[model samples]
Target: MGILSINMDDPMDVDALDAFLKIAEYRSLSAVAKLYGVPKSTLSLRLKQLEGELNTSLFLREGRSLVLTEAGQTLRTHAADILGRCEAARMAVAETLDDASGMLRIGATGEFGTAFYSQMLFAFRRRYPKVQLDLSFFSPHTLYLPERQEMMDAIISWDDGNAGQGGAEQLWTDRFCLYASRDYLARMGTPATPAELEEHQAVMFRQPAGPQLWLLQRDAETLSILPRSDLFANEYWTVKYFAVASEGIAYLPSFFTQIECERGDLVRVLPGWESAQQRVTLRVMRPSALSRRMGAFIDFCRDYFSPGYVFNGPRYYVETIFNPTNTTQTGEQR
Candidate 1:
């Protein structure tokens, strides 16, 4: 037999209901106590207190098992459901404690994520030591997942439909230039004019096959190229890397290669005649409540790409402007 009666004005503790549900499921008070890391007497005392509050006999002893009464059956069903929902709510709230902490996922093309925008790695770390940064490279289609916004926070990519409607904004742009590793030039010689590029081993971006069309602009003059691509990669950074390894000449976005180009590791293939300058706008999206962490990333990039002013951090950059368009170089317009 158990306590029985009801007090309508008094509220039963939710934790007590959870304990009652666990005790009913396990049928052994000791088992529920051990599972909860409490003494068996504590479980009994709490259950007794709960029965007293509800003023009902919840359990009746039948040999080793404690059978549930009509009231117990009702409370057990409701208790499991309510406690399950409470646990879910707890996990949901725990995820938002961005106290400037936890993981912040960012996406970008390999070329852009590595070269210019990576400055945020050092800068952001200096500010938020507890927050972890997960930077993913270009390609395989896994890098950009706009459909799963809960997992991916923001992305620095072309203003494609990836971000959707007002979720994305134009951060800025990175100008492009023609380049080849010094070692490659030492062996194959350099392209004195854009026309000579056809005769050279050229590394190209992610395209299937055949000769590619390269459009170059200098003032009102536009030089269109039908250069032969001897090597191919799915991403721009990979193309630049192939060129750096002395594979061949490559056209690269300016910001990331500035440090390497200045170091003479990768030399300007056509220093006199500027290659086509490509401008791609960086689109970032972090909707709903995680805007603070997303804001930190955006601000960090804004400071790093502040036109001509070199980032005085764990990163490096040279102040070089191609022509016509000039503002703090951030990303690409794509």
Candidate 2:
């Protein structure tokens, strides 16, 4: 018996192969069509042509769904490798032209996306104007889901030391600490100890797994307190806003509060004690043969989060604080 080979010379063979791969991935012709903005009939015809060329039935219709046959499973194994190699070759050729232009899809938690990543992305755009940025915000719980992950090239998330399997590069560790507006402390009277937290109202970060106990640590001692929360928000930005409004004391990440703290809009309630420490990480979903745009963005982010790199964004107070030479000299100094 002779082995049948697909003719690569025909352009239709390539389109059929691409269609077959997408259909196999989504398990539906309509899904593949809708995703790629192609007509369902076109995908069906391509899939049929592919199956005919291979001389095998690829899919079996199971009620409302389509399941891959044994032959389809075998083809899928090689199809992904074939497409990946083709893409690698394409990216390599594109790099030779020395152009950093492409769509970079990124995913992050809503809070982090709004509070920090959005600003960083804006800064990135100023440098690479040709690269289009698509930032999608997902819930903390659903951010790591495989289906959601497939939609993004890179994902920025908090690594609590339990992200198993995938290679996630640690960017920085953001420490959560107690904070409140100075006006709130003046009105409520600042707590001298951890136990005194019960007397003050809290503006808390609402967790999907229900209420969380605040675990405060100082040196060798650890204490847990369930403060009465009047304001609860899923977004850290909202919690910080309420805290700045003097609604209650907030336990927020230091990264989100840096500008506020520097501006004296919000003051650390208990400077000596710290709460949770979340390690921020950037996970590149597609790690092989990264495009020039993707490589440039990753490198920019690494330097942005580096130690003592004060953000020189619109409200540039941190730059003045970090780089005193940038500050205007007063008459007293002159």
Candidate 3:
């Protein structure tokens, strides 16, 4: 028989549980101590206290590796679960604070995330000093889970392609322009119209043939301008580079090449030819409504990337007053 029976009514030693869980995740005492900014001796003392309470040899040494014993592994799983619950509770408490302070996990496409509103990244850090914003970038062409429930609090993608999803805000829209380096244009004659794209060395964004297909439209006319390129890249930025290095003609966002086009680093072909529309939309993944922190973020975008800036579509004229009328006819409205 055991020396003593376990008491069912005793409270859990949360501090010890936290330390143990950290040790398990990292698999090294020194690592955990370094992470927690504490001495190894202190961590060892706490681990011993936990083992004594549980009455188990929680770990076994194998060369330089620390392996969890059978008993240790069992306890570790439960310990992690308990620690997770505690963290959730802590998060709930922190969320209730007046200021929006906590982690905001965000996911977005590569080029769009950096290019469209790079300023917002800095602004968010400055404004919400307490909020830890983590942005995970993915390729725009890749299919990702976008219902707003998994792996992200918010997302940025092409609006036209991803309509009727959850809470969405139109960040900006820019017409695609044909870009080729000066050398490439000199080698291959500059295309004068959409029809001529078929005759050129084109690098195309391959779309799967389905109902949810991308249409290359110009001036409200959907042209059968199915241009092809031997060299293909999923990232929009990569396409720009290919064009600059004389790989092929790439249809890319106007604003992305604004500086390049102005400086003549890459020449814009077919100025009169309207390129396809690309919409940069910000999406939130919440069940019913948004939190205070989430709402604040949306407002921040509205103020920061305002009209006449990134959000201003092709139809927007400098002199005319800006309004988000659903009637605005451009490649992408939002």
TM per model?
Answer: 0.55, 0.67, 0.61
Poorest lDDT segment (10 consecutive residues) of candidate 2:
325-334
Flag the better candidate by TM-score, 1 or 2: 2
Task: Put down candidate 2 lDDT per residue, 1-334, tens digits, no spaces.
Answer: 2133555664436677778877876788887777678999998888888877776788898987788888888787677667666656766776876667767889887666645787888888888888888787777677888866766788887763434348888887877889887767888999998888889999888888765567788988988877998678877767777777667998877877887788777788889998756778888888885789889988988988888666666532111123233233211110
Worst 10 residues of 3 by lDDT: 312-321
Superposition TM-score, candidate 1 onto the true structure: 0.55
For residues 149-247, what per-residue lDDT tens digits would candidate 1 score against the true structure?
A: 333567666433354344565556645577886666877888787778878887877544543455576677778775677687756766766766667
Error of 1 at 305 (Å): 2.2
Residue pairs in candidate 3 whose N, alpha carbon or C atoms collide under 3 angstroms: 148-285, 202-229
Whole-model lDDT values for every prediction:
0.65, 0.75, 0.64
Model 3 stretches with alpha carbons more than 4 Å out: 1-92, 95-98, 117-119, 138-148, 206-220, 287-289, 308-334
